[model samples]
Target chain A: MTDPARAALAITHEPEGGLVLVLRGELDLAGLPGLAPALDDVFALPRQPVVLALDDLTFLDSTGVSLLIRIANHFGTVRTRGAAEPVRRVLEVLGLAGRFGLGEG
Target chain B: MVTSAPRRLSILVGVVLLLITAALSFLAWLAHAESEENLLRRQLAQVGTLLGSQATVLQVQLADIGQVAVATDGNPSAFAAFADRQLTETGQSLSLWRVDGDDMEQVALQGVPPLLPDGGADRLTELEPDGRLVMFGILPGEPRRLAYGLMPGEDNTDFVVYGEAPLAPNGRVEPAEGSPLAGLDLGLYLGEDAAPEQLLQATAPVPIEGRTETTSVPFGNSTLTIVGASQGPLTGIQSAALPWVVLGVGGLLALGGAATFEFVSRRRAEAERLAAENDRLYRQQRGIAGTLQHALLPAVPELPGLEVAARYVAGEDELQVGGDWFDVIGRGPGSCVFVVGDISGRGLPAATTMAALRFAVRAYLAEGHTIEDVLARLRGLLDIETDHQFATVLLGDLDVPAGRLRLVSAGHFPPALLADGEVMLVDCPVGTPVGVSPSVADSAVTVPVTSAATMLAFTDGAVERRGETIDTGLDRLRTAAGGVVSRPLDGMLDDLLGALVSPGNKDDTVLLGVRWG
Candidate 1:
C-alpha cells in the first residue's frame, strides 16, 4: 500500500549538461505532494532543457498530469520520455501527449 | 430492516421464558415445604393421643385391685389369693400392703415387689379420698411401679395395691410395630405438667429440633402427660427428603436454562462482530477503487476560438468504478481531436485499459496519423499486450480555421450534430470495436463544419436503460440536444446529461462536447 504513495523523484546531470528529473512508482494525488522539492531543485539548475523521464512510473492520475503540465510550463524546454503505459494513457487522455513528448513520438 | 426485527424479538422471548421457569420452580419448592410441615404436625398429634390413652388404662386396673384387697379386711391369705389371680390375669406383677401410721407393711406378694422409698407408702395414704395414684421408682435405673390407696372400712383404715410393669415391652417405649408413629419419639409422664424432667417413658431419642405434641390423660386421679416428638418434622425418609429434592431439582433446571441462554447470546454476539468486520473491509476496498478511477481522468484544457466541455459522472453505485472516458487532445495550431470511449467491464482493470487506449490514440495522432490509422494501431497494441478487452470509441478531428471536421466510428455510437435548431446523428463508416479483430477496413469522412454547429459525443451509459433499445436512447438524446445546442458548451453538456441521465442509472457516463466559434 505504501509503495504506491512512496513515488520518488531524482535529479541527475546529463552528459550534455541538461538535467533529467526521474519520477518512479505511482504519481497520483497521494504521491503528487512530494514532487515540489524535486521541481524546485530542477528549476534552480542552469537554464537548459530538462528531460522528465517517466519510464519507471507504475501509475499516474489527473492530479499528477496537471503537475507535469506545471513543470513543463516552468522549464523553457521540457521534454518527456520513457512513460509507462498507464502514465502515458493519462497524458494522452488530457491531450498533453504532444506537449509531454510521450509514447513513440 | 426486516431481518433484524425478528432477531430482537426472539431474544426478548428467550428472556421471558427464563424468568417464567425460575418463578415456577420457586413456587413448586415453596408448596412442597409447606405440605411436609403439615404432615409432621398431624403425625405427632396422633401419636400423643394413643400413648396417653394406654397409660390411663393401666392406672385404672391397679386402682381396682386395691379395692379388692381392702374388702378382705387386711387378711394376708385372702388378699394374696385375690392379688395372685388379678396379676396372673393382667400379666403384671403386684403386691398388697397394709398402711399403719407412716410405715407400709407388705401383706402379700404375688410377683415382683414394687420398689417403694421410705415416704412412698405415706404419700399413698394421703390419696385415700381423692383416689389419686402415686407412682414411685419410675425414674431411670429404678423399677417401674404404680400405686393407689383405698379405705374399705368406715373407721378409715388405709389399704394399698402396688404393681410393677414394663414401661415398654422390651425396655423400649416405641409405638407398636406398623403404627404411623413408628418413626417418632414418645415420652410418657405421670403428672399434669409435661416437662423434660417429668419424662417417664421414651420410645426414641427426643429430638431437640422437631415437631412435638403433648396430651394429658386421667389415670385414676392423677393426669398422665404423653409428649410425642416427630422424628425430624416429616413422617419418613421420603417425606423428609421431599422439600430438599424439590429445591435441588428446581435449582438444577434453572441453572441449565441460564447456561443455554448465555451460550446463545455469545454466539449471536460473535456473529454480529464478524458481520461488522466484513462491512468495514468492503468499504475500505471501495475507497481504493474510487481513488484509482479519479486518478485516471483529467480536466479538459481551454483552447482559443473553441468551446470544449466534458463531463464524467460515476455510476450511482459508489462501489462500482468503470472505464468510461473522454478526451480533447490538442494536435497542432487550431486543430484538436475529441475522443469518447467506453471500455468493457469495471474496476481497476477497465480503468487501466481505458487509460492505455486514450494515450495510444493521442500518441498516434501526434505523429500525423488519421482517426482510422490510430484505431488500427490501438488494436494491435492491445493484441500484443495480451489484454482480452474491447472498447467502443468515436474520434473526430476538428480544424477550427478551415471549419472542416473529420469523423470516424469504431463500434461506437455516432456523434450528434446540432445545427440550425435541428439535431441529427452523423453518418460515418463504422467498424468493429478496437481490440476485437486483428485488422479493420474503416475510413474517416470529411464534413463541412460551420460556426453554428455543436457536436456532442458520449458513451452508451448516457442513453441506455434496462429493457430499452439503442434507437430509443438515441432519439431521446437528439431531442435533448436540440434544446441546448445554442447554449455555451458547458451549459449544453450539462443540459444534455440532465435530460439523459437519472439517479437510477448504474453505469458510468462521459459526455464531451465541442462548439465551433
Candidate 2:
C-alpha cells in the first residue's frame, strides 16, 4: 500500500512569468523527498512570482509549513491560494498567511 | 505479578522434556548393548558345538580302526594287509603290535609309527581284557595327532592296534580352512582336564581373557575338552555407534530448544517491561496535563437569576492531553462572558495554546471589548505566538436580567438552546479559525433567552468520532439536551455528557450550561 503521508508535487510554468505549484496529499516527513526536487526547480527558475496552490492537500505538518515558508523567502513575490482548511489554519496560526499573500481571492 | 507464570511453566516443561529424552536415549543404548552381548555368547556356543562334533567324529574313526586290528587275529601278513587297507580307507595311519614277555614289537605299520616307544612296551603288556588307551601327542615330523590303541581280548598273546589322525593346530578334528571356528582361539584337552599340561593342541599359547565355552566328547578311553574363545565381543560398527549418536543428538536438540525458548521469553519479558514503563510515563504526563488544564480553566461565576455550570473532561487517551477548554468571567453585576474553545492539536503544545487564548479572552472582556473585538484580538495573539497551533472558539455575552445572549463563532460549533421543551442549535456567522487570518471579520447574533431556558455550548469532542459525521454528534447532543433541560444545571450536564460522550473518545471535551431563571 502506498503511504498516506507522502505528497506529490506538480509544477507548471505560466506564460506570465509565474509558476503554479500544486501540492496534493499529505505533506509530512514521508513526502519530503518528492518535495525537495520540485522546490529546487522552483528556486532555479528566473526571478518570477510563484503561486503555491494547496487546494488538493489533505494534511500538513509543522515541517511542511516550514518548507513553504522557506519557499516564500526564496521567491519574494510568492502567493499561496486555494489552501484547504487545515493548511489555512496552520498558515494563519503561524502568522505566515499575510506575509506570503495567502488566502487572496 | 511481575514474574510471568507462563515463563515458569515453560521452563519446568523444558526440564521435564530434557530428562525424558535423556532417559529414553539411555534405555535404547542399554537394549543395544544387551543384544550385542547375547550375540557374542551365541557365537561362542556355536563354535563350541562345532568343535565337540568334530572330536566325536575323530573318536569314532579311531574306534573303527581298533576293531579292524582285532579282526586281524595276530597274523603278521593278515595284520599288514588289514592295517594298510584301514590306512587307505580312513584318512588315518595304523600300526599293529605283538605282545611277548614284557616286550612289544611293531609287526605291521602303515602311514604311522608305533603307538608305544620301544622301552614303553612293558606298560602296554599290562593291558587287561579288551583294554583301550586314547592319547594326544605330536610325532617328531608330523602335526599334532590323536592316537587310540586297543588290545584284543584277555589273552596276553594277541596284538594291539593303534590308529592316529592329524589334528588342526588348535586340536580341532576338522581342518582349519573350512571350520566355523577358524578365526577363534581354541584348546583341546584330553581326559576331561583343561589344565595346561593336559592341553593336547592349541591355536594360541596365550591364556584366554573373559569367558570361554567348552564342550566335551568321550573317546574310547578318554574325554576330550574342546575350549573355544571368541576373537572379540559380537558388536557391529553401526550397532555400537548408533546408540551413542542418538543420545548425543537428542541431548543437543533438547539444549538448543530450551535455549531458544529462554531467549524468546527473555525478549518478551523485556518488551513487556518497556511497554509498562511507557504506560507509566504516559499516565504521569496525562496527570500533569490534566492539572494544567484544570488550573487554567476558570470556575463558572454566580450571576444572579442564572444557573451557570461548566465541566471539562479529558480525553480517554491518557497520553493525548487535548486542547478543549471553557471559561466564565462575570462582565458586570447581571452580565457574564462565557467561552468554550478547542485547539486543533493535542498534548502540551495544545494545552499551552488553550490557556493563552482563554486568558486573553478574559483580558479583552475585562477591558470592555465586544465579543467580536475579543475574537479579533485572540486571532492576533495566536498569529504572533504559535507556529502551527489554532483554536475554534464560541464566545458569548449573557445578560441574564434582560434575557438576551450575544454569540460570536470562530469556526467553532454553535451553541444549542433549549426552550419550551424544544431544542435547536444557534446558527451564527462563522469566521475562519482565529489563527487563519487577522483580517477575517467576526459577526455576532443576539437571541432572546426565555425564563427557565437553557443554553448549551461544547467543543466538537463532545460530538465527533472516528468515522461518524459531525452532524450526527450534534443531533445526539440536541436530543440529550432537549430531554434534560428541566433538570438542575449540574444534573442536566451529567445526563448530556453521559449521552453525548462515547467511550474511547480521543479528543478532550468541554461543556458549559447557562440556565436563565
Candidate 3:
C-alpha cells in the first residue's frame, strides 16, 4: 500500500548486549512499498530474546511509531526499549511508556 | 584614609572661610562708616558747647572793656592799656574804639590786628544801626569781630569796646578755661557771617540745627550773637571678624558635592561591568548549546525495505542536555533492532552520557545479544564508563517477515501499537534504568505482528516534567498518536512526533517506529 523506494530498515548490535536496528530516511505512505515488506521480514525472526536498539534513526512519523508499537505488542514477553530520544518520546506519548527500557549488557 | 578625608574636609572648610571673610569685610566697612559718623556727631556736639562758652568769655572781657571806657570818659589811653593787659593774659584779641561823636578812634592794639590792609578802619565803621561793634580781620582765613553797646550812660556820650578773634585752622573756636570741647578736633562757628542768621535758619542751608537762647553770650564787644552749626551728629564703630562663617559653609558644600559625584560614578561603573560580564556569559552559553546539540544527534542512516526516519532535539535550557537517543541496527534478513533511551540531566554532561550510551547500544546490538543480556551489558558499560550514569531505554527486535516484534524494557516507558485502526498501549514490565542495577531480570514481551501495523517506541523525555504526572503526559501522547491510527508506519511516526514534541522545551527526544505493511 506504501511506496518501497523510499522505505528502508536495517539493524546492528549494541556493545551493551542488545541488537540495534535502525530505520533510516522515511517510513511513510509514499514509502510503504519497501516498509511493509521489511516489517514482514522482522516478524519472521526466530530469535527468542532480541533487543531492538533504534539509536541512530533519523525520522519516524505516526506510521513508524505504530509499527514499533505493534512489534512491542507482538513480543509482550520479549521486553522492548529504545536508545534513541525521538523514538522513546513517540512511544511514551502513545501511553506505552512502561514497555520501553535502557538497552545495555 | 583619615588623613585624606581631613584634607578634603579642610579644603571645603577653606572655601567656606573665604566666603565668610568677604562677607565680614563688607560688614566691617559698613560698621566703620557708621562708627565714623557717630564720632563726627559727638565731636560736633562738643564743639557747639565749646563755642557757646567761648562767646560768654568774650562777653565778660568786653563788658570790662566798656565799663573801663565809660568810667574814664574818653580816656582812650587808660582803656587801651587795660585791653592790652586783658588780651595778653587771655590769649585772645581785644580792641577798644572810642566813639568821640562819630569820630570813632581805636586806642588799643591788643591781640587784634587791622583787617587785612584793605579799608581796615572804614570796615569797622560800616556797622549795622543797632551794632554794638562790628569789624573784620584775618587771623586764619576769615575775619571775625566782637561788638559792645554803651552801657546805660548818664553822660551824652557813648564809649564802646570791640574785639576780634582768630579761629584755628580746624575751625575750632578757641575754648575758654571751662569748655567741654577742649582738646578735641572739631569746628565751631559762633559769629554771624554775610548772611543774616535768621535767613540761614529759614533756609536750613546746612545740616546743623540753630539754637537760640536769651542768656547773654558775652562777646568781647559786651554783646552776644546766638551760635549754632550746619551739620548733624555722626556715629560709627569698626571691627574685623565675620568672613570666616561664609567661607566655612561654602567649603563644606563643595566637598560634599565632589565626594557624592565620585561615589555615584564608581557605583555606576561597577554596575556596567557586571552587566557586561553577564552579557558575555549569555553569548558563551548560546555557543555551547549550539555545538552540544549538534554533537549528540545521530546522522541519518540508510536502510532498505522499510521507511525509517529519526529526529533528535536538544534541551533548551543551558543547564545541560537532556539524554534521549535512538538507534537502529540490522540483524538478519527482514530483522532489525530498534532502541531509544533517556539519559538523566541536561547540557554537556548529559550529552557526554548520551554519546557513551549510544555507542554502548551499538556495541551490544552488534554482538548479537538478547534484549535482557544487552541491557545488563549496557548497565555494566555505563557503570564502568560513567561511574554509574543512569538511563532508561527500550530495545526492540523486529521480525518483519513473520509480522512480529519482541521488546525489552530497561526502566523505560512502554511503546504504542496501532493495529487494525485501533490504538493500544503495549504494556511491558519495566526493568531498572541501565547503570542503576548490576543486572536485569530476564523478562521480555512479545506482541502479535500484523501486516501494515505500526509500533511506536520512545524515551521518557517525550512525556515527563516538573508539576506534571507522567500518566497525564502519556495520555496526551496516546491521544495525539491515535489520530493517525491507520497511517503507514513512517507517516504515523511523523504525525506522532509532530503532535507530541513541543519545540518550546529543548530537551532531547528520540523516537523510532516500524511497521509491517
Output the number of the TM-score-best candidate.
2
User: Which 10-residue window of candidate 2 chain B scores lowest in summed lDDT?
Assistant: B133-142
TM-score (0 to 1) of chain B, per candidate?
A: 0.72, 0.70, 0.54
* Alpha carbon deviation, residue B60, candidate 1 (Å): 4.9
Per-residue lDDT of B345 in model 3:
46
Q: Best candidate, DockQ-wise?
A: 2
DockQ of each: 0.01, 0.07, 0.02
lDDT, candidate 3, at B295: 70
Q: Candidate 1: RMSD over Cα atoms?
A: 16.2
Return the lDDT, model 3, position B60: 57
Please give each candidate's TM-score: 0.63, 0.66, 0.48
- Poorly placed runs, candidate 1 (over 4 Å): A1-105, B1-32, B63-182, B188-194, B203-207, B210-283, B317-319, B332-334, B383-388, B438-440, B483-498
Question: What is the C-alpha lDDT profile of model 1 across A1-105, one tens digit per residue?
Answer: 224346778988688777788888777546756676776776576666779988888766434554565566556566788875556544543334555665365
Docking class of 1: incorrect
> Is 1 or 3 the stronger prediction by lDDT?
1
Q: Write the per-residue lDDT of candidate 1 for residues B1-55, one digit (tens) a residue.
A: 4345545655565556656656765665566556666665566556556655655
Candidate 2 docks at the CAPRI level of: incorrect
